[model samples]
Target: MNAIIENIDVLLSGFLTTLGLSALAGFTSFFGGLILAGFAISNNPTLRKISMLYVALMQNIPAAAHLFFMIFILPVLGLKAPFFVLAIIGVTIYFSAYYCQAVRSGVNAIGRGQLEASRALGLKNMQTMRLVVLPQGLRNSVPPLINTTIALIKVTAIAGVFGVTELFGTMLQLINVNDSAVIALMLVTGIGYSLITIPAALAAAAVERKVAFNS
Candidate 1:
């Protein structure tokens, strides 16, 4: 208790780092995943093939392996990024593959007639995606998108392994120093993460139901 009170600033700083990483990864994955979905559904066979390969490669690569490559291999090739930035970039690429699949399914669920209608209305392909297809597909994808957001928050723990002082990293250090406070620290971290993830999941569920009814 004394240590925790004394280290409140350290713990709060760590928590903020974790939250920022989560938000960065979440927003990038949403937009990047949408772009990947667009590629996957493109009329160009070459673009679709490339998108398929990208998703497959990202999905098959272990997260640790991906992290190691980004932090290790990329630097050797002269592309050095800060730890937090690298972690966010790597996780966004990894998780966005899954989101691509989810969003692709949502896009497919919308009938071809929607695209045809957009085309008939003089909307270009980009305009159709921006104004017609993606909006409806995203509304349909809200549930899965929410699930992915929760998953991304938990996945930010991976940053700890890279020496990023996120909440988990901070907790690990504190527990190691105090030994007896391990359980308490862990409980706090878990509760903190849950506070972020649970509401996101619930909100997604509500939006999904509402979208379904309006469809």
Candidate 2:
């Protein structure tokens, strides 16, 4: 109790850092996924291939490897960034593949009839995708993407291992010196994470229900 009371400010700071990472990564990954989804469905064969290559590479790679490459390897190549920025970059890239798939799943749910109709109406491929496919695809994608975003928030805990001192990292730091309060520290960390995740999970469930109802 004393340890927690004494470290309230530190815990709050780390919580804020976690929030920042989650929010920034979520925002960037959303756009990244959208663009990749677009390319995957494009008329240009090269673009579709590029999209496939990118998604395969990102999806297959371990999340830690992505962060490790950014934080340690990139510096050797003369690319430098703050640890936080690197964390964001790594997380955003890894999750973009997931978002891409979500959006792609949405695109697949779209009827072939509408696609053929678009061409019958003289719309070019891009025009059809932009005007007809993506809007509906994106709408359908919301629930899964929300679920993915929840996962995204949880995965940011890995950032702590890479020296970002986020929520989990803060708990680790506190536990080292306050060894007797280890269980308390763990509970605090779990509660902190649950505060964000529980709500997102509930919201994801709600969105999922709404989407299913509408569909």
Candidate 3:
């Protein structure tokens, strides 16, 4: 018990580290995904084709391989980022691919007539997308985005394997240093994540329900 207390600061530090990385990556993925979805739905066939290939490449690649490539290949290009940064970049790229698809579906779900009406009212493509289509699409997209955020949180554990000292990394250290208490340490890590994530999930579900009723 005293050892657990002694390690409390380390655990808290690890939890915060994971939280920060998850939040940064989540934001990056959200915006990157939005841009990719826009490109996918653009009028130009060439742009759409490029976007399709981008999604296909990312979706087909295994995430572990992607991370390895990011860590190894990026350094070769003179970008020697820290492990946590690389982790965020890796997960952001992966999550953005899926997010783009989800948001694209939401964009498509909007009726063509509405777009035509906006154009008839002298709205440019940019104006129509910014002021009308995207707003509605975002409402439809949020629930899935929240779910993806939770999944990203879970996936950030993979950062530990790269020597990023997030929650799981610290847990790994603790388990290795004190093998007799592995189960307890794992439970501590699990509970730490649950404390942060459960509320976000519940709030997202509530918002989704509200959007459904309003829609």
Q: Which residue runs does candidate 2 get wrong by more than 4 Å?
A: 117-127, 213-215
Clashes of each: 0, 0, 0
What TM-score does candidate 1 reach? 0.86
- The lDDT per prediction is 0.85, 0.90, 0.85
Q: Which digits, one per residue and each the tens of the lDDT, describe model 1 over residues 134-210?
A: 88887787788788888888988878878789988898889889887777788888887888888988898888878
Give the clashing pairs for model 2: none
Candidate 3 structure, TM-score to reference: 0.88
Ranking, TM-score, top scorer first: 2, 3, 1
Sort by lDDT, best first. 2, 3, 1
Candidate 3 weakest ten by summed lDDT: 206-215
- Model 3's C-alpha root-mean-square deviation from the true structure amounts to 2.3
Candidate 2 accuracy as TM-score: 0.91
Candidate 3's displacement at residue 65, Å, is 1.8
